[model samples]
Target: MVELLNAPNIDQYAWGAINGCEAASLLEGLHCLGKLTNVNYGEFLKQMPIDEGGNPNYGFGGSPYKNQAGKFEAIFVKPLADWAANYTTYEDLSDSGVEPIYQSVEAGNPVVTYVTVHFEKPEIETYPFGDVAINNHAVLVDGVNATQVHLSDPIDGKYYLDKSKFEKIYLSRNMALALLK
Candidate 1:
């Protein structure tokens, strides 16, 4: 078992928003990487591109505070990676599977991964560009053990998800982002 100690536990709602889990998780990863010390979520949110037109690949879609039915409500690995690049090196670990994810935790790197809210069963919504998980949410993976993955969830804070269950939701899109120092 390996864990990245002192991983930031940020609540998505603490910053006056119900969304922005992606940015929250990214901030946790950045803190884990020692890339950020004094954190201001409002400033960070301002730096992120808000793509109200539903382009997950380019930037965040929809309102970070509320979910719109037709717009893509989350940001994917690409934009997160692009944003993190300004602070430190990053790995676009999309479709890379679970082993590398665990390895990252072992190496003391926190990974921002896309999983369903509360780790529930995924509900995919089809977009004109492609199918997207309607319940899509992001969390920072800060630890891994023999049978569990430790996460700093932006919505629920720190918790453990069974490896099998985490894998199930994770494999739905197989998307992960990590910051490297």
Candidate 2:
């Protein structure tokens, strides 16, 4: 088993309602890599880009303060990666599967990965642009073992998820961002 100690556990609710998971996960990853310290959540939230039209590929879709349906209410790896580049090096590992994730963890890097709320079954909603997981949530993968994956979740803090179950939800989108030192 390998676990990176001192990974930050940030609650999205502390920053916003149901929309700050991405930002919170990013914060956790950056902090885990020692790239950021003494951050102001308000200032960090203000700097993140928001695409009100529900295009998560470019920026966060919908308001970070609202939880209404059909607003997409999520952000993907691209925008997060671009924004994180300002602080530290990052790699967009979308569709790269679980191997790289373990590798990143093994290298003492935390990965910000997309998964459903509480790591539950994904609820996908298809839009004209693309499919969006309504329960989409982001968490920092900070540890790995033969049977379990540990996470610093934005909403639930830190916990261990079954490796098989984690991989199932993880591969659904296979979206991940590796924060490198």
Candidate 3:
């Protein structure tokens, strides 16, 4: 038996347009962990790791302007995990298979993963990594009951999606994931 849950109160638009969905989803996961363990996540998110770019930085952190590219999580996720270690440890689940993802979610932390900006709609472009479609949004995998995956979309809110659909978008974006333990 495996059961995991996260807070559904992630406000992806908390910082107006400065913070991206990825940052917001990370915030949601951290806040949920804080609630589960009684810690101060509010103070932490205000100073979380961020990409250094144009006005998008907006002091805290912001997404890159259109037409430009940057590895969003590479700029923060690992570092956030390192910083959060003061409270509890975390695991890097990037490029992992579905079973590991299931294990990660079963462990309590919702998997902070990516999906396409439009879910099924993506504009193919050649990035520094390779010629592939881009994942322009961030979401949390709250739980997995068999093949059904429950997720919280920072933009669309909470819902359960088909595993195949989730995998399609996730794998296409390189299966980027991080877990807090």
Candidate 4:
């Protein structure tokens, strides 16, 4: 994350100017370019939102949405099912067990992985509300311990999730992205 926020010559390593598009549009175009195939993590942070003045939304790191970082996660993973047929082979996720699923390692392509993102409405939140209306956002799981999922809301920038507090959440979507490894 630090590297993407500070990297010089980032445009040379990847296309899509940071300020060029909203998260959804940027993800869609990159998926079309074939530059973002199954690869994960390596180039993702580059597409993160920058303020109109070309500054990182520093508040983001401290926001309640931090762990619940869905916009980016969903934007990254939404297009993979379309990109799958382009893969010469398919890998199964059932074997990944409790770990996040890992897939793809093709030359000139990004190694991508898929993970499910679960969310819940905010009516049940106990935290004090501020700039972000918790009711408007989804829950982001912050920890994974066997059958348990931990979540954080970036708006608070503090992780306050517990195993049982989030049953109100639902699976909003499945995410896919290229992995650095």
Give the residue spans of candidate 1 off by over 4 A.
Answer: none
C-alpha lDDT (0 to 100) for residue 104 of candidate 3 = 77
Residues 66-93, model 4: lDDT tens digits: 3223322122222332333343232322
Q: How accurate is candidate 3 locally (lDDT)?
A: 0.59
Instruction: Locate the minimum summed-lDDT window of 10 residues in model 4.
Output: 1-10
Candidate 3 has which clashing residue pairs, if any? none
What TM-score does each of the candidates earn? Answer: 0.94, 0.94, 0.71, 0.26
* Rank order (by lDDT, best first): 2, 1, 3, 4
Candidate 3 lDDT trough over 10 residues, lowest sum: 56-65
Q: Rank the candidates by TM-score, best first.
A: 1, 2, 3, 4
* Candidate 2 lDDT, 16-59, residue by residue in tens: 66687888889888877776677855567777888777788888
CA lDDT, candidate 4, residue 173:
22
C-alpha lDDT of residue 70 in model 2: 62
- Deviation in Å, model 3, residue 22 alpha carbon: 1.4
lDDT score at residue 14, model 3, on the 0-100 scale: 52
Q: Candidate 4, which segments miss by more than 4 Å at Cα?
A: 1-76, 79-142, 146-148, 164-168, 172-181
Clash count for candidate 4 is 26
